[model samples]
Every structure is written in C-alpha cells, then in structure tokens.
Target: MLKGRPLQYFGTCIALLNMLGMGWPSPFLPVLERDPLTSITKDEGSWIATTYLIAGPVGSIIAGIALNKIGRKRSLLLSALPFLTSWIIIAITQRLGFLLLARFIAGIGGGAIYSVLPIYISELVDPPIRGFLISVMGTLTIVASLFINILGYYVNITYSSLICTLPSVVFLLFFPFIPETPNYYIVNGKIDVARKVLSQVRGRQIDAEEIQELVESNEKGLAKAGVLDLFKIASNRKGLFVCLGTMGAQQLAGIVPIIFYTQTIFEKAAADFPVIASTSLLYVLLIVFSAVSSAIVDRLGRRPLLITSISCCCVALLMEGVNLYLKSQGGLNSIGLSWMTLGDLSFLVIGYSIGLLVLPSVFLSELFPLNVKGLAVGFCNIYFSVVAAAVSKLFQITSDHYGLHVPFFVFSASSFLSLVFAVIVVPETKNKSLEQIQIDLRNKDEHNKGEQTHLLKKYCSEQ
Candidate 1:
C-alpha cells in the first residue's frame, strides 16, 4: 500500500458509492415490471433501464468543466447531489415518468463521478500502485453494484433505493476531510497548496526537484491545451483514438444485456436457483475476479489481461449466440434447463468482470495528459453513454425482431474487433509516468511519420 492509503481509499469509496447507487435498479427491474406493486409495461421497464445512459453524458460534460474550474474534490462532492436527490425522487414518486426522471438525474451524477474518479485516484496515488489503485476503483464499483443488486433483490424498491442513497450521503460528508488532487492544485496555480498536498498524500516532503518537475509538466500541458487541442495535438489525437477504442469496447461489450437479462435467461432455461441467487453468485465472482485483477495488473500489464479476458468474452458470447439460435429453432433439448447456456454466461461474466470492466477507466486515467485528462474522460463518457444507450435499446429490439442470437452475435463480433484494436493501439503503461507515456506516444507517431515520408519519396523518385 502507498503512504496515506487509508485516506486515498476513502476517496475511492466515493467512486464505488456512486456506482453502487447506479446498480440499484438493475436486479429489481423484474419486480417493478411484474410484481403488481409497480406493474410497469415491458416498454416502460426498458426505458427505466436506459434513461441513466441518456443523461450520463450530460453529467460528464458538466463534471469535466467543473473539474477544471472548481477543483476535483468539490466537483465530485457536487456530483453526489444528483444521485442522492435522485433516490429521494425514487422513494417519493409513483409516476413512471418521474421514475425515468430520477434515473436520469442519477445517471447525470454517475457520469460526473465516473468521469472524475479515475482522474482523482490517479493523482492521489504514486506510480508504484497507481494502476493497482485505479483497478481497485473498478473492483469497488463491481462490489458496490453487486451490493445494490443484492439489496434490491430482497428489499422493496423504495426502501432499496433509499438504502442506496446512504453511501453518497456518507461520501459527501467524508470527502471534505481529504484534500484536493495535487495535480489539480498545480494546474490551478496553487503551488504551495500543491506542495502540501503532495507531502500529505505521500507522507513525506516532496523535494524541490520533484515539485519543479510537476510544475514544468503542468506548464507544458497548459501551453498545449485549447478548444481543438484534443484533436489537434498529435499525442492527444492518438490518446483519443486509443481511449475511444478501450472505453467504447468496455461500454458496448454486451455487459448490459448480460446482467440486465440474467433473470430472463435463467427463467427461459428453467435454472434451478432463483435469478436473484444466480445473479448474486456471478456478481460475487465479478468482485473476486476484479480483486485479483487489481492485485495482478501492475505485474501482468494491461494489454495481456485485456486481450485474454476479451478473448474469453468473444468466445463465450459466440457460444451464447449459437445456443440461443439453436434453442429458438428447436434444435436444442432441455431437461428443466440448459447447463451449457448458464455455463457460457459464467465464462462471459468472469471475463468481463476481470479485464474489460476494470481496465478502460484505468486506461482513461493514465493515457491522457493531465491538461486533457478531464476533457478526455468527459468525451469518452459522452461517447460511451450514447453507445450504452444504443446497445441497451438495441438488445431488446434485436431480440424481438431478429432473435436473441442477433444481439449476442453482434456483441461477439464487437468484442473480437475490440480485442484486435487493443492489441495494436493500446500501450503498456506498467509503472510509467504520464509524461513518459506522452513521450512514447510522440516518438511512435514520429516513427510512423518517418516511414511515410520515405515511402512517399521512393514513389516520387520512381515516377
């Protein structure tokens, strides 16, 4: 563990709490749909699940701007307001529209927290365990999400939602004790405060040399930043492409359908255990796998774990597609249930839990330059929110018109393609600094440019 880890972990819990609040509605959607208590239609039920995504991008954009203007801790503290207020809305509202509105509001907060958390954690921890702690953020979200899923599984909707809000309330209160990110302070011209923060977080005095290095990096970052800088700067442009691929793949990896349709799949297969129990089991594994991932990511490197996990995901989704296709055509036989179907899902859940779930946000935190970190995170969230919304809605439409196999096949194909993109585009950060990553990206681009120039000259001379 790094120095001042307990305080750092407290800050990271805010990220977990935010995501836990987001997960409350997933497992209980069944109750809201058919329990006769809420009694929402199929269509209305689907909308309730997706409205979070639609509003997420909006929250992320606001968080990005606020991250720069107000500072990370306060921006994060403010982000909790929407999620807490949202649970209150859920407890009070019986109207379907109001329910959707509440989810949307919470999604907004999630967007901000999701966008800002990686940045906050990255700055809080040193390089040795930076990836590990960032991965911890990922595991914590799974833990939080699964806890809410289990809570919502047993409890009534209003009480479950009210229970979920408590984390955010606790976060809002406890976070003031933690200081702002030194990177944020440095960037905002709070040099003395940045020094103190760095000392406090590291539990040792930051030497003049290290402080100077940080200040110089921020100066360079500020000089290069602008409205179109994300696209205009060569290093940032490459970072953007890589971030998009990783973030998009994570968001669109059919995870929503995997978790969202867990009960549906179990019901169709006539699984022995209740959907709640099976879902709980897989989610428990998700936490376990994520913890293992956090423990090992610093040593194993990001690319291998991602490639391996996603490869497993690709195969599992394909197997799932085949099984669904065969079952729909009556080519499959069942004795109360199909073990193969559940087995395929277990593989998929384990794969996603370990790599795809944890790494993309870590990549987002590490890959971008500090000046563009917030903007890059914001952009990825907005993009991911749109993709998430599409996949959520598409899962139903494709399942209805095209059959469940269609969406499964589509997801399988996306996973395979994303795996290839990751192999080629994503770099191994390992224990490298953000400045080091920028330099490496710049050099790689220059190498490519040199080859292109040579090829052009050779062709021109031949002509």
Candidate 2:
C-alpha cells in the first residue's frame, strides 16, 4: 500500500526462516530418537528441543553492541551467517551431539534476530501502520513454525532442514539492497543519506518542518545509555518492567514448551489419535488468529487485546488441566471425551496467537526511548531465553514425575497471575509515534509523584 511496504514485508522473510529453523525439532523429536544414525534417549531428545536457548543470551549481548556500531542491516546480515551454517549442519549430522550443537548455533542467530528486527521495523515504518507491520512479522514467524511442523511430518528431518536454509540464502542475496533506517543515518550525521532514505520510504520529499522534528528527536536520543541508565531513569525502569513481565508471563505459561513439544503433548495425551494432524491444525489456528490480531491491533489498542488474551489463556489452560487430570485417572475414555485434548489445545492456540504472541515484541519496540531501546530490548530478549529454557525443562520434568495435568495446572495458575499483571501494569501504546510514547512514559511518572505529594500535604494539614 505504501511506497516501500513491499520491501518492508520482504524484510520479515529472515524472521520467518529464523523460526523455521528454531522450531525444526518440535515434530521430529520422536523421529530423531528412533533414527539409528542419530538415536537419542528421551532426556536427550528434550535437550534437542531446548538447547537453542543456551547461546541466546550471548547472541543478544552481541546484538546490543552491534546495533549502534554496525547498524541494523549489517547486524541482520551477520546473524544470517550462523543461521545458514546451523541448518546445513542439521541436514547432514550423524551424531546427536552435532545435532545439539547445531541447535545452539541457531539459537545464537535467533537471539540476535529477535533483538534487532523489532527495533529495525519500528524505525522503518510510519506510525499509522507500525502495529500492523510488526504484527505481520510475528504472524510470519508463526507461519514458519507451522510450516516446519507439517514439513517434519511429511518430509525427512534432513531434507526439511536443508530446505529451511533457503531463507537465509535469499536474505543474504536480497536484503543488502534495502536502505538503512533514517534514524540511524540521522544519529550518525549522514543528513543527506537520511533524507534520501526517508523520502524513498515515504514516497515523498522531506519538508523543512518534518526534517527539523526528526533532527530534534535524534538529538534527544543521542545520549548514550549505560546499563545503570536502564534502572536509574524512572521511565526506562517502568518500560523494562512492563516488557519483562509480559515476556515472563508468556514463557511461564508454557507457550514455548507447547510449541516445541506439540507432537509429544498430543501423543502423551492421546496416543491413538493422529498427533501430527492435530498439531498442524493447532498451528493453523495460530496463523489465522495472529493475522486477525495484526488487522485489529491499532484499532482496539494494546491494553484491551492483552487483557482479553490472558483471560482466554487462563480459561483454556484450566480446561486443559481438567481434561488431562480426568484422562490420567482413567475416566476420560469411559466418558467419551478423548477429543478434549485437541479441543483444549486449539483453545490455547487461539488465545496465545491473538495477543500474547505478538504484543511482547510490540511493547519492546514502543516502550523505551531510543537511547535505551537497544540495550533494554536486548536484555529483555536475554531474559526471555532464560525463562523459556527454564519453563520448557520444567514442563518435561513435571510431566514425567507427576503428570501432564500438573504442568497444565501450574501454567493455568501462571496465566492468572499474568492476567493480573496485564490489567494492572501494561500501558496503551496504540496510534502513538515513537517520541510521543517516550513523553507519555515521563508524564505518567511525574503525575503519580504529584498525586503522592498532594496526598501527603493533605494528611499533614488534617492532622
């Protein structure tokens, strides 16, 4: 619709491929354990599903350092190197250790991509379509995950992995032609380049007033932020809290484990059913509902969407926990409710994809000022990997020791906590420019301080 919107859409291609490689192990875990050339134990198979997170923090740190030094386009190009190598390794690896090593390498690329891409896209697009564009990127990642699930079911793991490498190859070949962000050029004092790139993106020449506004915005953001600045500044501190809370809630609710172990969950819940088909259908719902969210996010706003999503997830998880509990106790079959596993999982997919899946990235891109955004979002992604790894392992341990219902119940409770957090803490960021968001964060903090002082003075006079 816009001048450079096609290229913006193409920019999301790497993200799609990133998730494709990241989610490769989800449906193939059981197959890998049974393959004679790369046989692994149940415990080792779990490692294959989660070891991508091991190197994620390191990659995020690298992305944080590179965002300013190398710029967004080059950082993305650097990330593609690891992605290409990892997928190639997976395609030919005969040893289980090699397979796990490949996954860790992919995690490195994934971490960098997650940290950099959101900030890049936010800076590139206009405010009117910013939410839609970002949400579309999230949707494409979901589509990639779904594609891997179906591909693993129909094709061999080696062949599927080799196919996954194509996205990286395409990105390397095409992405270099795209322009860097206007913000990055302005900050670096490349005014002519910034103007040319901005006009190209906007389909018009830059006017004097807009150019002055852009200069002033860049000037405000030019102050370099240290790690302490994240917590030392009140607005930055609040932004970090909001981001971590959303990411933590999503991870703790077992969304990562659910996506990574979809076939495993279905087999454990209902062995006789067609697990792959059910899993594929579940991901289809994710893609469909995530698209719906992309279409409506700017109109409905962030706060309401998050509230509705968490509420739906809480109910769905509770239902899933109850269904598993009944099935585990040997009563589910007698009552003719075996289909409830698929039902509950479909509910979870709808709930997660609509809001929880996409909003975390949106918050990361919108909340913090440019000065702290790269560092704050980098740390946020690092924290996301840690929680995801812990929760994924915890899901396996609890399900094996106690029952599948135990983890489901725990996740249900976690969703309730997340719901409370969303309602109480998350801010509305719809239809606001990046600079406007920074101003609002400061204004809200100052307003709260003024209210506290007035209440204190009132109490003193009354006493």
Q: What TM-score does each of the candidates earn? A: 0.95, 0.95
Score residue 44 of candidate 1 by CA lDDT.
90
Candidate 1 lDDT at 290 equals: 86
The lDDT of each candidate is 0.82, 0.82
Worst 10 residues of 1 by lDDT: 15-24
Clashes of each: 0, 0
User: What C-alpha lDDT, on a 0 to 100 scale, does residue 21 get in candidate 2?
Assistant: 46
Residue 199, model 1, lDDT? 89
lDDT of 1 by residue, 1-463 (tens): 2457666666666555655566655756666666675788888988888888899999999998998899888888888899888889988865788888988998899899889888888888777788888888777777877887777767877898789888887776667777888988788777889898888888788988999888886666655366588998788888889879987788667987668878777666667666677788778888898899998899999999998888988999999889888888887776423677778888898898778888988888887777788788899999989999899898989887888789889999999999899888888989888778878888988999999999999999999
